[model samples]
Target chain A: MNTFTLGLVVVIYLLLTAYLGYVGFRQTKTSEDYLLGGRTTHPFIMAISYGAAFISTSAIVGFGGVAAVYGMGLIWLTFLNILFGIFIAFIVFGRRTRRLGRRLNAHTFPEFMGKRFGSRGIQTFIAAVIFIAMPLYAAVVLIGGARFIESIFAIDFNVALTFFTVIIAAYVIAGGLKGMMYIDALQGGIMFLCMLFILVMTYVKLGGVMGAHQALENMAELVPEGLRMKGHQGWTSYPAWGSEWWWTLTTGIILGVGIGALAQPQLVVRFMTVKSGRELNRAVLVGGIFILVVTGFIYTAGALSNVFFHRQTGQLAIEAAGGNVDRIIPLFLNSAMPAWFVYLFMLALLSAAMSTLSSQFHTMGSALGHDLLGTLFPKTRTNGMVITRLAVIFGIVVSMVIGYKLPGGIVARGTAIFFGVCAAAFLPAYIGGLFWPRTTATAVKWSIATGIVASLFMLVFMHGSESAPLGICKALFGRDVLVEQFPWMLVDPIIIALPLAGAVLIAVSLLTKHESALDV
Target chain B: MFGINSCGIWLGYLLAVLSVLLCVWYGAKKWNKDDDSAADDNWDSAETQLNENL
Candidate 1:
């Protein structure tokens, strides 16, 4: 509404986040406190914190925009998010990971890998990769948040970007993971309330559920000529079962986000923050309910936006936002909601972005400072906290540059790329290390190496777009590279690469004799 | 206005709430027993390890 009101709301939210960070800082005493909240975080806080970190601006802005363009079929992703991202993640992965982490006394993801496999070198390599790749994902999210601020406040993009980055970095550098999780829990609650309100309001604004569905069904006949030619018949119905649209929906959206959750280093580390399996078990329900509201509401509202905007403006809201799908949700909120609600929604969106951004920055910083450099130069003995703070600053700069320079429309693709790499490079070894007693350290090491090398080589050499990596796609594939041609790459490296990595681990473990000095 | 989608959403929430309540009940029941002797033994071992490290 008014500039002063909006500014006041923003300032108040920032102060609340800073206060939480201060509280976390006060409680933090050792590396354990900074890394894992001293392993005593309450169950409810841990659950919401984990959910908030998992469902970032990426899901709300990026995936929501995609849903607006693609139709309600993307709602399946929300279902998968609750089932896999929350339920399976907590039940299947969280309990075992917490136990193993305590057993190994590992704090960060890279440290977990290193200690599990008994190889300092493997941990260093994993840390280096995380440091290099995660910033791109972080930057894309920063851009999403900044763009919303620009739209609402009429602020410069660069200025908004810098402000968002600096605020998140300050608290994260000060409070570490404990600060990040406390703020995340609060943000998660805001996100749930905002989504509930938005969903109810959207339906009310559209008359009712039946009326909205009827309107969407009727609007299908009026599908644009270009979309019809490309096989989009309507927004009312599912895409043809065997069509390219169906493949993209199933492979690209559903499997990409769903399977990718397993290997997310940020989410995995949340397991280490609790004391026992019971705490993780308790968190499962909270996480599931949080996802059900947050993701379910976002998808529902996004799909309904098609009906609202099309009836009013004779076009989907995404098209109205100049084809930048990520801006669709913000644009809709600006147009549809009351002025005060817009400020509230902005706060929710900021919470979504900052919550995830803080976690990503913290994870990346630890990867660099504690895992990689710490392992490689063991005698350097630099203060770990100082190195981590500097790494956070470095990460912010890298992500900012990438966010500004990368061509737009890449947020969705960039998310797929990062998640795919994680699933491939880490999933096999991580799973085997936990469940399989015979998984040798050598086998684990080679599997990780193979998975990372193969996935990266595919991304750079075979899968890159025409402008990527010196036109290597045209040279190799004899056509401008299509992510669709090798759709497996777009899905997750895990499905293919995990099995391959598993095979290598098994074969190598079988061939090599067990060492007499093995610690385990 | 509360239709199938709302019903589904609420059902999910109820299931989650029930699960959480059960977990809290179970945790409290298990951990609130008179196990101070066992705890003391564990602490003694930890203290010995700390002394060795120092």
Candidate 2:
């Protein structure tokens, strides 16, 4: 907790990050190198960078807090992350993405889609969506990192936010994807080791694994009165089937994030960074283990923190953190671990935030500069690197402004909203483009358009979780939600829009003429 | 199995462990396989055309 020690640790970490950024900058010789790391990234680096970029403060701090409240049932997300995010994503999606990206000479996700279907309009539309929606996600991550730094360093939030933004911007602009990957690998390693240490230390503090879990189950009677009414079961157990809690856990958090990861622009581009399917295959081994330790342990540690709090203060984790779920993990860390580990965990968190932010900035930059502007104004294509670097700065500035402007509650929903929107908007077309050769460009256009429109509509009107907070429905319809009925209000936007979009795509593709002879 | 009583929660934990194993096995089996070369020849000219257009 010493200011001098904390300052020294941060300085060393930043200095190391700068060195990696410089390495990436020196290696980038062409636009291809800046955009896709020249298609020769190492498997270990690719996998770790992908995993680190995929996870953020949202997973560790935000979702970890949710686990403290929701219990180990959140582990289903971990299982799904490995099953879908790593296994299917790498083997099924990653292989095809690399092949198709190379075949089309596409550097960005939007460009891949645009070239695959031979429609620059499709490319521009997807890029526009990324530019508009991604800043919200970037802003929330910015705020999360800044808030943590504010709490730990006793600095102004503005100072923390600017420091975090500048560090990420420097690396991403100078090094591009290649530089970002190197930093991501380092950050990922710190995160994996720190999370492992916390998991082991937590279990040790609370008897052992089984003992800790059993202790949690024994305190089932202490479930908050309000939560029990909504089908709150013990922490170690799944929520009651068909209960409100079950729907929220299953459909909202688990399905929203778990399945939504496949189509992420930032994550997808990592697949295109490597040379061949062999590298992707090799990456799966490392990515699976990385996700398991980082995600699995945090969710487990979050749930088990209840036992520690209960033993120490006779209060649940939520109560111990004064009912703010966000504080539970930090409170547990400060209380349960030794002082030095807290500082190390802080570094892991900074790594988490920076890794994710770097990718977000890079993706946003490419979307605006490479995909949208470069396509629409052909002359801008000549200065692609300059345009992209300036776009990264624009993204950082937009995100920073939004970080200051947006209310606190909406920032918490930012990850879910962005993930759900991306899945609904991109997943159907992404799958069709990758696997189904019969898929028409017209079908992709409609599917993508429907996905974006329907998801946003659902968020604004029907899905109570987002709709209530957004207050647009209340302002317009004079009601909290468009539907006063049960479950409709509870459902996540992804559940409705993703299927509708897919159905539209399939139905339309069947009826329309096949436009391209290109086969996957 | 791990002192968690719920069958569903236990299944989740088991599946998560199983998934990691699956990735390891698949990766090891296919580590050196080059599956893209056959397709690379077909796309060579198309890739060239696309690059020129850009």
| Each candidate's DockQ | 0.12, 0.72
Q: Work out the TM-score per prediction.
A: 0.86, 0.97
What TM-score against the true chain A does chain A of each candidate get?
0.91, 0.99
After TM-score superposition, what is the CA distance of residue A230 in candidate 1 from its true location, in Å?
Answer: 4.9
Query: What are the per-residue Cα lDDT tens digits for candidate 1 across A275-341?
Result: 7766766676567668777887787688778888987798877678887777789888888888778
Candidate 1 is scored at a TM of 0.86
Model 2: share of real contacts kept: 0.81
Give the TM-score, chain B only, in order for the candidates: 0.47, 0.69
Candidate 1 stretches greater than 4 Å from native = A228-233, A379-382, A461-470, A475-478, A482-495, A514-520, B1-54
Best-matching candidate per lDDT: 2
Residue A66 Cα positional deviation in candidate 2, in Å, after optimal superposition: 1.3
